[model samples]
Target: MTRFAQAVAESTRSVPVPRRPDTGRTRVTWRQRLGRDRVLVLVALPGIASLVLFHYLPLLGNVIAFKDYVPYIGILESEWVGLANFAVIVNGDPLFLNALGNTVIITLLQVLVVFPAPIALALLLNSLMSERIKRVVQSVLYLPHFLSWVIVVAIFQYMLGDAGLLNNFMRDYDLGTVSIIGNPEAFKALVTGQVLWKDAGWATILFLAALARIDNTLYEASAVDGAGRARQLWHVTLPGLRSLIILLLILRLGDSLSVGFEQIVLQRETYGADAAEVLDTYVYYNGILAGEWGSSAAVGMVKGLVGLLLVLGANKLAHRFGERGIYQS
Candidate 1:
């Protein structure tokens, strides 16, 4: 070997060689991952069991929709009746239709009017400079969320019932008493108000969290650019919250058919089924109370399918608008 060949050999030896990437390495098995994170897996077992036991297991009971279900005979022993029960819904039982109408009306009111309330409230609360005052206000607002539907209904009755607080005050002053509690025309509005008052503050928690996540630098930049408060909100705040808003809206659509069962059931006696009945109450009355189990199950199954479709459609629309929505595509 010449000097030049020796120099080249030395130079090659001095240079570091890159190892090949481990493209052929086996991926970690789920079992291995679970073993490594056994603590987390153990912690999650209760929730997993609950979901399987409560949610997934009960889905099998939907078979009752196709059966002439009898409590004594049990689900397995019931005679299958294909789509006969669904004909009752299609043929338009007056009671079921009335309940469905009430449900749609209430859902629309909640979606259109009540839905934006928490966002507005959160924005207001977020803008407040006094943390102490905001915390106090938030506590007062959140208190109603902890109250049971029964308690909330009773509170409304006490305040709005004939000869209740408002009526009593009006009577004392010789003013005409207002009758709102059992008014059919006002039922939708009443429920909307009740939902807003009871849960709106609790709903604000998510919006507040989303608001908190918004980069303060964006606001600072907007301020430096001479944007007014309104401009900043419109430009920076709303954009930052767009994804969360879409996600919650999609979830709301998924649950559009489920206007509070307990709330409506509690008020049904006062307002009658005409005004207060919804799909859930209808199921309770027809299935549990009247023993028309098959028909009720059929109606419920349809409601669930509709809710599923609504969620899918809403998510699709969200994707069209460049949002990831509740789940990624």
Candidate 2:
């Protein structure tokens, strides 16, 4: 016991003590940090400039919502109308109500069907044993995302219009022509289908990335335990993707009101306003085309406020469910 205590004392004496860090050290100034990271700051300037020019600057235009904005007159000279422009919404104008209803229907369809389509595609692609076949399928699916709305609409019209490919084939077989393109009854379904075709594959990129991040050991361990593919997927794969899915869902809710202005507007005339009109197109036709700028701006402001509320509510719900959501808040 005496020798052991002597040995311990010797070892303790030989070891050096760690010095305390200086809590009183001067803090690094912003200018010093900027100088140290000058190269990175230079690299980020273009993106910062773009945000200021395209995003921040345009927020000033929302002021037009409260003004009787006439492009001929300067903003300073335009008459301030306050909430007068919002009277259409309060009074329940038929055109505005129709646009709102159509927007809601389309948004619901997209959330129910289009949102999950990419995840399903990603799972199927991941299950493929052959890499070449998987790449070919992915390439084919992703091709439509590169096509413009004009080309997408044109392609759909060529394939499904009254006198187009389907109708032509049916005519030869003595089958009656089906009205798809200019049919108001099928317009919502048609547009939703078009959105799915154009974007589903591109959206799959996120799920595929999330899948790639999942550890292979989990699958291997599950296999060793005699767990089937279904069990492994349920236990391992979905848990890995849950966070990303939640994040995307929150973001989707934020932009739920915006359902593609250019795409819907192109078909609105053919299907009539009742079928294809959405909040975005409503704002464009009334504000820019018809020169009801204040009212249009008011509608836009309302849409933005609603989307903001949705994001905040969703983020709070995510917090309650023990998820990070889009931000800490």
Candidate 3:
């Protein structure tokens, strides 16, 4: 009986236990482990859905660029024109070059001038000892960001238009009125100033957050080493914020073509499209107004492709500089 029991035990040991059936709940277990991150996914769902619906889903409509798109006939019934629309937008449209040129120039100016101002402001605010004064300054600066483009344009018009505040002052003083807003030559500066006024404060928030994350110990150590305030800022503060600065710079570069649409559109008529028309306004005028949907869509598709390329290129460049771009390596 002992030998028989031993044999049975050995057989049982040799035999594998019947594998438990998978309940297909491995993904659920992983999601549960994520905990708070699951909430982020839930929160992100709406935005993801919106982008999928409005941005990416509309990619299907790029087919319209290859066809003679007509509202009555619809995209499905439209006659396929292949490269005709692309050719027209590329060669036939004179305004395309003008708008593209203006957009590039304006975008470059904003990147060089306006983008750095926020970082400088953030550094300045971070250096200040008085929190109350910093808060007050921040509040005043941030006010313009909330104002609509219409209101912003109106404010500019009120201050710089032909018979407006500046002109009125010029007349009173018997001095020549400066053409700041409406003049074609001054349009770039005007747009840059407007962007600085409206968005510079808001842009500082990220930089300030970066500044806050900097190690206080570094500053203290720098002081111990007999470093002055400026030296501390140069050695400790700027170096600490380098990663954030590069990341933001890459993002701005990725969006180089998208300087301002609404602001430019609002004043396009006043300045003549020559001064104010950008890629966005070009789409509106050429696509919507002229009913050249195919050509306009082609231009838009080109811009989208270019923007994607720019983002990828900028990300690569940022990584080359030993900084994480939009995504970490």
Candidate 4:
């Protein structure tokens, strides 16, 4: 602040501003409010109905975790088995444990690598002087996001498969080819890479929006104070993005357990269960394929509970750091 501005602020600190007289604001009734917002309500009815139908209504099926839920017997007719279904988790079944381990490993890898990819890309994009170039690059980067998981997996298989581009090129040059697709050790990394390739560009949208919202004057002020580009980014850009970063981190933690059902399952047979199995596939194989409905329900319920705990824990951590994470305290 300038000297005059500082003096003005200091003077205002001692001045007690007169309070406005209380004019009671008339309270609007629920019906009146509803009438005023009827158009908005109408517009929102489909989304509300969809949420109730798909998200909330399916919650009732968690009861299957406490029952010997046979599809033929139907949900209502299923025998009460109480905690029997959860024994798979409590007793630590070998397959379940393996799936859980794989899940943790993939989630951690994503947190380390996949999560920061968009932020880095956004920064790089923001540094570009040409708007045309930025738009073209962004379009190319996110084009893959619109492609289905099937297409993505197929593209990777074609490029990284045993007889694919890498091996073909290596053969022409007499260089040894490294196995990537269907390799047990590389499956986790492969999954993370695929996620980064597909979603990173799409994710950059929010960060770019956040960057646009930052005050241009802050950058000007930092420059006036002799701050270089890197210093301005560190001091001005990152601080502006901190809250959004925290909010995204909290959300990502909540859904961390689900690596990719369709993506992983497509390659699971080739990689084998030990290499590629995740919680989603575990539930699918046991429930739909093997008809262990109750056990699958138990596992799924546990997944959701764990996710809830992660969100709550991360939100609290954000609060401690004084950032509004996902919600207000």
Candidate with best TM-score? 4
TM-score for candidate 1, residues paired by index: 0.91
**lDDT digits (tens) for residues 110-137 of candidate 1:** 9998899999999999989999999999
Cα lDDT for residue 122, candidate 4 = 96
Residue-by-residue lDDT tens digits, candidate 2, 1-329? 69999999999989855544676555677898999999999999999999999999999999998999989996889999899999889899899999999999999999999999999999999999999999999999999999999999999999999879999999999998999999999999998999999999999999999999999999999999999989998999999999999999999999999989989999999999989899999999988999999998999999999999999999999999999999996
Candidate 3 wrongly placed segments (more than 4 Å) = 1-42, 89-92
Worst 10 residues of 2 by lDDT: 16-25
lDDT of 3 by residue, 1-329 (tens): 69999999999999856543685333345555678488888899999999999998999999999999998989999999998989855585678988889999998899889988998999888878999999999999899999999999899999999889999999999998888777988888899999999999998998898888888898889899999988997898888888888878777766777777888888887789888889999988999999999998999888888888887888888888787788865
lDDT (Cα, tens digit) per residue for candidate 4, span 118-210: 999999999999999999999999899999999999999999998999899998999989899879999999999999999999999999999
**Candidate 4 regions with alpha-carbon error over 4 angstroms:** 1-24
Better of 2 and 4 by TM-score: 4
Question: What number of clashing residue pairs does each candidate have, in the order they appear?
Answer: 0, 0, 0, 0
* TM per prediction: 0.91, 0.90, 0.87, 0.92
What lDDT score belongs to each candidate, Candidate 1 first? 0.93, 0.94, 0.87, 0.94
Model 1 residue pairs with clashes: none
Off by over 4 Å in 1: 1-26
Candidates ranked, most accurate by TM-score first: 4, 1, 2, 3
